[model samples]
Target chain A: MKNRYDIVVVGAGPGGSMAAKVAAMGGLDVLLVEKRQEIGSPIRCAEGVSKKGLKKFLPQIKKEWISCEVEGARIYSPDGTMVEMAEEMAGSEVGYVLERKIFDRDLATLSGDAGADVYAKTNVTDLVLKDGVVKGVKGKHLGRSFEVECNLVIGADGTESKIGRMGGIDTTLKPIDIESGVEYIMTDIEVNDLCNFYLGNDIAPGGYAWMFPKGDNMANIGLAVLGKYLIKKNVKRPIDYLNKFVKEHYKDGKIVSVVFGGIPVSRPIKTISNGIMLVGDAARFTDPITGGGILKAMESGIMAGETAIDAIEAEDFSENELKKYEDKWRPTIGMKNERNYLIKEFFINLSDEKLNDLARSINEVKIKEMSVTGLIAMLIEKNPKTLENLSEILLKYL
Target chain B: MIYVDRYKCGYCGTCVAVCPEAAIDLLETFIDINDNMCKACDICVKICPIGALVDEE
Candidate 1:
């Protein structure tokens, strides 16, 4: 890595790598650093993505990156009512279960091929600022301290984004806006070619339990809840919920890999400060209701990459110069995130009785399309009185 | 002070996100909870998957 570069992208998840790749592809000097020794090991995500989303951002699907291609989804309400939807109608998260390790590494390689210097095991401990503007980063590489000066810093680091916070971007995540998640990659389990969701307050509190199939007999069983749900509510932790679900459902499955992390279910940060840009989970780009982020991360990474190029050309790294990014992403990613956050707020606040009523109403008939908005629209028509209090919020998304 | 059990800690960084005080961080090998910055709210302790964080009361 160079002592100085045009841009320093921190964290090698999808967001950082894509930013580096797009910037380097624009002929800017770029350095991508990942804190881990290996690119995408000790996996943390649920590893599911949309085939349509993949085709939109990713160049082409590599055989090695896929775990399975599920046909659709089955959502269970608190009353055990199931609503089945086809993969095309199952919304953005239902098509492919990725081996994220392979997918993330491949994206980083794409960045390297585009001429960005990529280094793993380099931890960015601090940012170097001059006159209140970020100029570089200080960290350790291979057990030795290292520093690199850059005109811009892309904080693609995940949910707990210290870079964003240090760079004067408010990365504050409220307990209610954060979802603590844990997943177990299981083998020799019973599952079909469908992604399954079980929703209930008693089972998952402020979130849901999911089984995203990795194969016919393998799946990732996971649970996530807002921190408030777990904060002194008789439940000690999130794992307790997952353990109980496993005992009741997939008790015979063998655990292969375990991963845990937090997802920001809040709106995107209000601003991107001078010389600093937050992408992916760092920017709270994960979908609020579904907690899915790969596609959003890639989209924001591309936007950040494009912004970096413009900043270098104009030689202006001011927040004004970066406003074009907000201009481009806000309408797309930002507005979508805002809509979803509102929807998330509405859903999580619903009592089990309301959820079951809504789910039963949804199950009573076959909706032609089964997206989040479609489901809520169906509820509006079916249980107008029950959801009347929340219809004002969900209506805009429709 | 909140004591994080390093052995059971999954280093998932969940604690770091939910920490309104921004006291917890995922260090190189383990999670580091800065006592001086901690407010002892136990929000991190409640959210941790393994219950690795403890309010040392």
Candidate 2:
């Protein structure tokens, strides 16, 4: 294997693979490395992506990658009151539940086909730094230590992004800004085409539990609780919550697989660093409210790839050149993340009674005609007492 | 022996991911640490996001 490349991408997730593919397509020597023996194994995500968001980047998705095409969602309140919305009304909330194993492998395969060299089980241990500038990475590839030099490194590692830290970026999360999640892939159950979200303090304090249907008899049932709430409730792990939820709901469902991971619910860092760009969870690009990142990861990956190419063409791989990625992603996905953060904060503070009230109000509204601001306005009108709690949020969002 | 704090665990499976020996198994309701498989390397203790896993005194 070559010991040097123009660009070396760490972590062959969606973001890394996408960056590699685009950079390789631009005729750059790109190396995409994965610590895992397999490109995508022991998947961590619930694997749900809205068709609208995905189609914007990927023109057409292959059929094999999609496990289930959901038409809508059923949101359950604490008291089990359900409020359902169709895909169109739900907007970005509805789409395909992907087979992430296949999706991730396909992404890596695409990067390879685009002329990027891909390696698995190549764990990057540390950054190869020259005068505080990231020149490359040193790691073990199949038990042999190797150092690969590159002009630029893309940290597409997930939430636990070691590369981001090695590049001198603070990727730490406040307890409130971390969502600890656990999920079970279960079969021998009946699930509709509608994806389901259960909200209430009892279910998943500071977050929500979800049932993303993969098929009529199978689904990825999971819950994410805010780190702060987990400690507050004296909850041991997210799996405990999952166990309780499953016992109540899917008593007959047999567990086929289990997955767990953390989601960063905080804002993106101010600077991702020079000569090293961070994408996906490494950059904290996932939505704070939904904990959904696949779309944003790919989107930012494309932006980073294009920016890297531009930087290479300009013969400047400085922070100034890499700042273009931050500039481009901020106004688009970054703004949405900020808004979602506000929404998440608001939801986290509400009591179960308040959530029930909110759900009841939502049930009465014509959700299709209601914007987020409009919904807030309606909530205040219906429950005038909630004005004190919601006025500030309304002022900002409305 | 490894100690798992039942209250602090969010069961994100970071321990399992980092454990070289695969000593940790996330069961239906809790994380099971196999004593035979555990090398007390403390990788799980360090990797735990919620600081749920601990080494016995």
Candidate 3:
């Protein structure tokens, strides 16, 4: 309720709340604002987060936020050939399908517990500046617009973040880099507890369909395909394709809910600016291929919070100093995004027959039988001639 | 024209919440309608809170 604070975080999703929590824990005066009356209401995500990525922050696992623990993953070829790996060998980050509402609220609660002031239903309309630097934000609360000041402002406002855009960052995504997604949560279904991924152009182009089991007889079934893929296929919306799949495949189950959203399939923005920083989906910190963002959002949130505290304590919140946060997250999450970009490009450009052939080739590998290294070896074995193409495509990864 | 307003639709399970045959689902942050499974029942239209959905005919 004070007019000014040491730090002000805009948006109360995972990123913003995390930043606020860290800043508060650092003993700085912090305020977290959310446009919605509830922190996680009107959710816009796939709701999957890796256990590996989360352990570094919270350390202790909270049970209430998790819907189901995913032990391993199953990859289905276009022809329905299954490639699965054991739980222990699938790397360190096998994930959990979360109840995002509880997860988000818990994060906000942590911020409050850490001594940050939290405000909900507060819509920030514009930024308040002093000497050309972002000093505070002006927005409406309960029908009256008010302004508040702070040493730093953080934007975790989501993919179509007004704060990031208003701050003069381009934040524009190409059609190919935008994914249209649709999903349904259904009950009375029998499926393996592990998450299942389906790949084929008919189901989703330049993307894949996923069925994440939340509990017995219930699952979140969804697909995310690039905008370019939809346009090229002449589909008006991604939901049409998803509905068709549901009808053909899930005949007996009853749908309990439906979700439609867009995921930015691009790398994080290069510069979120000197005094202003963007985190989470607002910064396009989603995985370009998988369309998963929880880990990256939390990761970026931690970095942003640390940097904001540093800047505030230093008494110099300049864009140059804040760029360090961007630098740290961009290399890990950003580089993976670049790889996804290449893989997406290759997958999207392939003809239907090529896709089928690719599936068959992958079937030969039985990638589940191989480790990450073994999978690559099998791929190399089958397509000895593709080494050059793979090299060219994956050059940046090296 | 029949259309869905993306911003208003929150995948709340209300439309799917009232469907007789289990035709609706609350996926992630939004809703997905199975046109094949839908009988064009006026149930969804009546239950939708934000008028995000419309009956074409």
Model 2 chain A: lowest-lDDT 10 consecutive positions: A366-375
TM-score of chain A in every predicted structure: 0.96, 0.94, 0.92
Worst 10-residue stretch by lDDT in candidate 1 chain A? A85-94
lDDT of 1 by residue, A1-398 (tens): 78899999999999999999999999999999999898887788998887888889876889899999877778899889998776455444447999999989999999999999999999999889999888899999998999999979999998778888888887878788888988899999888877789999977878889999997799999999787777776774778888889999999999998889898888877548989988999989998888999999999999999999999999999989989888988889888889888878878888898788778877867755646676667778888886785688765654
**Model 3, residue A153: displacement in angstroms?**
1.1
Kindly report which residue stretches of model 2 are placed more than 4 angstroms away from their true locations once superposed: A88-94, A369-398, B1-52, B55-57
- For model 1, the stretches where C-alpha displacement exceeds 4 angstroms are A87-94
Question: Which of the two candidates, 1 or 3, achieves a greater DockQ against the reference?
Answer: 1
Candidate 3 stretches greater than 4 Å from native: A88-93, A231-234, A364-378, A393-395, B1-57
Between 2 and 3, whose TM-score is larger?
2
Indicate whether candidate 1 or candidate 3 has the larger TM-score.
Answer: 1
Q: Clash pairs of candidate 1?
A: none
lDDT of 1 by residue, B1-57 (tens): 788787888888888887778888786557888889999988788878888888987
Per-model clash counts, in order, read 0, 7, 15
lDDT of each: 0.86, 0.80, 0.72
Q: Write the per-residue lDDT of candidate 3 for residues A112-202, one digit (tens) a residue.
A: 9999999988878788876778878898776678888876888887755666655777665555667767778889987766778888878
Query: What's model 3's lDDT at B15?
Result: 50
Best first by lDDT, ranked: 1, 2, 3
Which one is best on lDDT?
1
Please give the distance, in angstroms, between residue A74's alpha carbon in candidate 2 and its true position after superposition. 1.4
Worst 10 residues of 3 chain A by lDDT: A364-373
**CA shift at A237, candidate 1, in angstroms?**
1.4
